[model samples]
Target chain A: MRKGFRTDLRWSDVTPKEKWLNRRQLMAGAGALVLAAPALAQGTAAPGRYSTDEPPTSLEDISGYNNFYEFGYDKEDPARLAQGLTVDPWSVVIDGLVDRPGTYALDDLLSGVTLEERIYRFRCVEAWSMVVPWVGFELAALLGRVGVQPGARYVAFETLLRPEEMPGQRGGTIEWPYREGLRLDEAMHPLTLLATGIYNEPLPKQNGAPIRLVVPWKYGFKSIKSIVRISLVADRPQTTWNMLQPNEYGFYSNVNPQVDHPRWSQASERRVGGGLLAPRIDTLMFNGYADEVASLYAGMDLTRDF
Target chain B: MDGAASLNGALRRVPVWAVCGLGLVPLAVLVWRGLSGGLGIDPVKTLEHQLGLTALQLLLAGLVVTPLRRWTGVNLIRYRRAIGLLAFLYAALHLLVWLWLDLQLRWSEIGADLVKRPYVIVGMLGFACLVPLAMTSNGWSVRRLGAAAWQRLHRLAYAAVLLAALHYLLLVKVWSAEPLLYALAAAGLVALRWLWRRGRSGTVRA
Candidate 1:
């Protein structure tokens, strides 16, 4: 949660000082004692291994299932359908207001950055969640390379559009080839990530393949997958969802429990397969990344702007 | 007396009820799994997969009945009703799982999904078409409708099968070879039926 703390060891290093007690193990051991004690004497339920200091239910579960329309629309469609995507020759074209505007190979983009294992809650706009351990450098670090001009107000992302490689493009389901955008400040948030992998493994093709953006605070779609282009522009870029249904999916698709999606309430999300025992947790404003990204939208009325 | 003896012989050779009972194994297994909580941690996904696969299997089985009957010269016509019914049963289960488990019985949301999602719409269409076919499968309805009308009504199953395949294909974002394979098989079956019908009509005209 610190702003600029750099630990010398690589994320994979199993250093004794770096390794902490597993929270799940601790909870399993102490849960019975806490349950037996008098109700008044008992403290709040001990946070589990993946628990963070962020406000309860505010932090989006980061590892939730994703429906990257590129792969397929089904929740598991990405995993099975994405396998056919060719990711080896992936390149991202950076254009618009930036000084350095050229296509960069995915390997070049990942070369110098240090990967950090950040565990964050990821809440989908569809109302589901999961805690994911993402392996990537901060989005701020990546954006720093492509110096933003003073007038630059927004960042636009474009996903791959080849029909041959992506059969979903052949259909007219969602206007084909997906696109997403974010405000420059939101794009540069420290918590935002240009993630290349998950669970320490190279991202499966269905999960955006070579590289995908992970904006924990925003709706999952805003974190575009199979990104092939990024444009720095003065005006807000037209996003896919906003284009499809502006009334439903606003340009600023931030996770706000108050602003219900036109069809369904965004107030709560099921933790996919969390079963009958685990209650659907209430969704948090800003997906529980408020302390980190709330100030960016502080004065703006999120309900109207949302 | 000869016609009566032939009719009696055909009825005696094939025990339609026993064959229909045998087809109930899959449904029994599905129910057992649901009750025992063997649907796994993600019951929705499990149910969806099972129902989808069962629908595919039943469709395949129904397609095979005609070919097998023609090749073996056996009274496979009797089993057609049972196969058609089983396909309807699995399709209904597929619809129910989506309704109860996926949509949580929220009719408004279900309506919205049907309207917005093309796959859901196609699936509903397929299921709706199967309803009339299943309803008229009985001997009484067949007798009332007559053979010509009955065959015309039952031809809707071909459309239902195609719609079901399309529904499966569109539902997934990525095209898995499995769904594509099923689609291809369904296409072949429908094509074969058309060809056979055309051949029979040509011979009759000649």
Candidate 2:
């Protein structure tokens, strides 16, 4: 879309996929680290295709801090409480306006497709950020396989709502089975990833195990976690935060520094592991995926929809 | 000689210095946590939030002293100034952390934030109310303004505490028990003050 945009860079130039896969097998054979063994067994993703130049926040910080309200409200609650979650037997139901719609097991769904690493800049609506290396395939790949109908204009998602499993549900703060939606165009964008892991390992339960959506252009909340259902719809679908507080959290929620949150400024963001005195840096529009996704919004008013 | 002797007596009765030491415990713990890496991934935010909460907690503690004296007959009036001053210290630390650590001394941005962020506006209003209170916490100011005027001016604490509590409530994106509990506590303190005034008025009528 613009001169010198990275679309020209081949995947092999960015990442030597074969060597990365071999390294994983080598590590698995040697059993170098106890913690890394199980993660490798699940199939380690090749080095990332699209990587943000920013330093990745530490594995400790990425895993430790989270806003999986299904686990709890506090930042650390998910890491502490999500251990009990059962994700190995997970399945996602696809229905509504699709040619093929059925409940598909996580492993069965991902069996044929290749998962590549995507290093993305994650900007939360709360004005904090991290650069995460997510392992997943493009949502478009899955949508293509499922065959989106001509009538479908929106894609809706739902998170697991088990009260016993997700302790935060007991608080009754938001309607359970957290829901989020995106325009069909947004869903099919190249940057839209259905992530299964981060940091070259299978996602920890706290970090949205099995599967989650990662729309790098939008606020982190729009990347719904621990997804249970995805439905293609004709009408605009309701989202969790939008339904909860329409004024504060909007449907678009594209990370725009100019559009400030009601409680705080979105112009700058604190890097997650950036210690006590770390200076907050300016936030980028569309979380720095403007080249790939900006045209999708074209003439639409993001401020009104945001 | 008599005034000097009464000052000494007041200090001994209330142990104001000891209360001040107790007030510093939160800051000490915060510093210790900072040095030891106990402050999780986002230490800056942890420091900012913990200091603000400490300030609010101390302010709430200061509000309780008047009621404690009235209902339980515990004359802690001497320690009130010490508690109020300590609360101001924490509030000042909170603001400094936000400005220096979070905003990195971007004066123009800070000015913009003050106008844009309602929580910051209310927090600043509470801090503004404290400036006069802290400036006049001494006996000289009481004597200068007359005790009636000084007490009336210090009554701004009730308003400051309310604003600070509101700042916390508005800052939190989610409705949780903790911030709500602080709001309830502040409200309860204000209600107690009103009830005490009503009881005094009834006694005057009698």
**lDDT, residue B181, candidate 1:** 93
Off by over 4 Å in 2: A1-43, B1-14, B202-206
Error of 2 at B78 (Å): 2.1
Q: Lowest lDDT 10-mer window, candidate 1 chain A?
A: A39-48
Clashes of each: 12, 0
DockQ of each: 0.13, 0.68
Angstrom error at residue A302, model 1 = 11
Where does model 2 sit among the CAPRI classes? medium
lDDT of 1 by residue, A4-89 (tens): 11334344442221122243234346774554343212211122222253322211112224476665555555666767888888
TM-score top scorer: 2
Error of 1 at B172 (Å): 4.0
Winner by DockQ = 2
TM-score of chain B, candidates 1 onward in order:
0.85, 0.88
lDDT digits (tens) for residues A1-306 of candidate 2: 011112353333332434554554565477547635444344455445566756677778899999999988888999999999998788899999999999988876786777777889999999899989788889999899899999999999999988898899887679888999999999998889999877656788898887999999899999999999999999999999998989999999999998888778888888888788665888998888888788988898888878
